[model samples]
Target: MGGAARVRRGAMRFGVERRDRPASERRAERGGTGRSPARRRCVGRPIAKARGMTHSPLRVAVPLGGTDRGRSGLGTWVQAVLPRLARRLRARGGELLAIGTPRDLDAYAAVLGEARPETLPAALDRAGASAGWHLAALGRLARRRGADAVLLPAANRRLSLGGPPTLAVVHDLAELHVRGKYHALRTPYVEHVVPRALRRAAAVVAVSGATRDDLVRHAGLAATAVRVVPNGVDVERFRPGRAPAALRAELRQALGFRGPFVYYPARLELPGKNHLRLLEAFARAARAGALPHHLVLTGSDWGAWARIDARARELGVRERLAWLGRVDAAWVPALVQEADAIAMPGLFEGFGLPALEGLACGTPVACSDTGALPEVVGELGVRFDPRSPEDMARALATALTHPVVRRRAAEEGPAWAARRSWCRTAARLDALLEEIAVAPGKAVAA
Candidate 1:
């Protein structure tokens, strides 16, 4: 294993904290006088109480899947939301159990040190098959541990846990609607497994209204079953700031880049993310002398990097292109702060977390008006049709040339970002858990 992987493995040795004991034991350990019957009823028993009863802390099980430790959008949201929910739930006299795959257990433990864990005995490489097995295992585990509710950060093949009512966070219905590309294989999984999971889940949480609509339209889920919970940002983590002088100097010297640069921080996935179209647009802008800025692409995967490099060379703008593959997450805010603008020409997204992150950093953004981009950004940034290079070139040119627009975006963007917070997201999640623990038959909380 590589150094990073080794470090991640070392971190998982420390086991996760779980609330597997009875409610009386938990209350006594915390120095409580006595556990109330209502509290005890709320802990391991089904919800069956008078309306408007005071809420109690619930034993919640959160399952981590898909990029749960990285700086990617989904990972970032999960990292922010889960711990806060755990902390808040604990304060309210409840407990949290975080379930993770054996492969990701270490990475997750590294990020969420004190959260309780129930490690799934399977690898994540085989996502579809592993998800089915893990879900069944999680159901049995939740019942054995007396968990009040279970949550999946991402979708799985099955979620029919015998113990607590289940919930899932569905980012989008991409595999159902968008076919004939890299995601073609996922069509079968999405069509067969996702609907069943949705049906089994008591509540379906979508990251954006667009995603909710997509799920209702394509997956045939009832609108009432889905709740729109937009993704949030860590305002303090990603704010307007200059790059550290030493680090900036080191990176500049290392990359041999000395001009203003347009930054694109996303995976180099083909088809959906559309890195080829971005390369084409950047080359056209460079050739026409319309843009004097260097293009900096920062992400993972060298195979995709080679393809983009060849395209840049074919367009004769290889000298103007720089690839800084996978930088530390701490440096992202500073790098985005230094850029003229952040560009995301993705063809689809569940919530477009990076766009919101860039905006939180007070950087102007130029993204395609596709998928959940418009929903996240609203009128705060510039947009273009992702399918056309000419449109992308025009949007890029506009962002580069218009100082007033950039300034306005910087002035208004942070406040827009401030509207969404992990704290609030957790509170909503807590409310849902309370509802499920009390009355599973009641329609899911709005």
Candidate 2:
């Protein structure tokens, strides 16, 4: 009856392929870095360092076990960090194995060349259910593959109960803020399963200080147990520039928009993402006629989208709003560049990736003062209370008005974004993993 029960029916037999690591330590090097060349073409500074790995080689696997592409924020985090991680590990004479569905595996292949994906018991694939099964399964496979440690790149609390040292990445504890939003089994999993999982990890990586704090307060973990490694934008792709003329023309025809627009690119998650309140604010701006910009909402329909659509109609922004569904990561830059401003009115976030991405593109950003947003947004954009539409409307209006001061902030935004580099994040994370692997008297410390 529950999601976990179904996956249990078809539990997997851990027969993941064999002999992934090199027999000897005479390797050359790993893949370079993660930032795509298209983005790099504009800003030549590489975000992934080419520094060789540690003296003692350690096998590492960034399992996609709990992270799904496109379907979750973990997807974005992986797309940004894993490639660089894979390379850094390989440079250290370590192997990086991907464990996920065929599609998820393929997504990482381009960034991590030819590292075969591992799987769970055959029956579990059909069940297509996630009840933290992958958590245990991945741990077992990592041990079998002789992995020194495993990195769980998603925010899910599900974790491998035992086996190799594990590091879990916590994005946010939104489930606690908004009760009754997730499915029946999921609620229990997060409340019970996650804290236990955090305890199981050798160490934990929090995307922001806020997230690190939540882990301590909500999960009852020690502050020393968590480390803050904020997310970084792909400055190469997100920097200021128009879309390819062809791209602009194609999008114009499809969306039929004639004026500059404000972008709110995030999955349509309910009160959690605060889409409804944003719509109300946009409606107020429209009524006042102070801002004539269109509102573009990209990303798939998550839970409360019907409510969002209905509210959109109520606010009379149906005409001004453009629903682009999900935009490919490749196109996010042009989308941000072409916009008048980027709006992130989420109730909570571990790290506001889109807001940073917008700033990297030299576009003004308007975000809520809650969560890690205020910290991430800093003075780059206007901050308002996500609960008040009047506040959001005013922030949106000021950004669109294009004041000289705001324009200067937009102009200086990219350099500010560049300072938060994936290279730096990766270096810090790499050091942490090796610290866990080589700690004396224990394989890892929590």
Which 10 residues in a row give candidate 2 its minimum summed lDDT? 23-32
Q: What C-alpha lDDT, on a 0 to 100 scale, does residue 255 get in candidate 1?
A: 65
* Candidate 1: tens digits of C-alpha lDDT, residues 283-337: 7655544568988888776357778878888888888888777887766776787
Q: What's the TM-score of each model vs. the native?
A: 0.83, 0.83
Cα-based RMSD of candidate 2: 12.7
Candidate 2 lDDT: 0.68
- What Cα-based lDDT does every candidate model obtain? 0.69, 0.68
TM-score for predicted model 2 compared with the true structure: 0.83
Q: Model 2 has how many clashing residue pairs?
A: 3
Candidate 1 RMSD to the correct structure? 12.9
Writing each residue's lDDT as its tens digit, candidate 2 over 275-368 gives: 8899998887666655678889888888767898788887778888888888766567778888888999988777888888887887888788
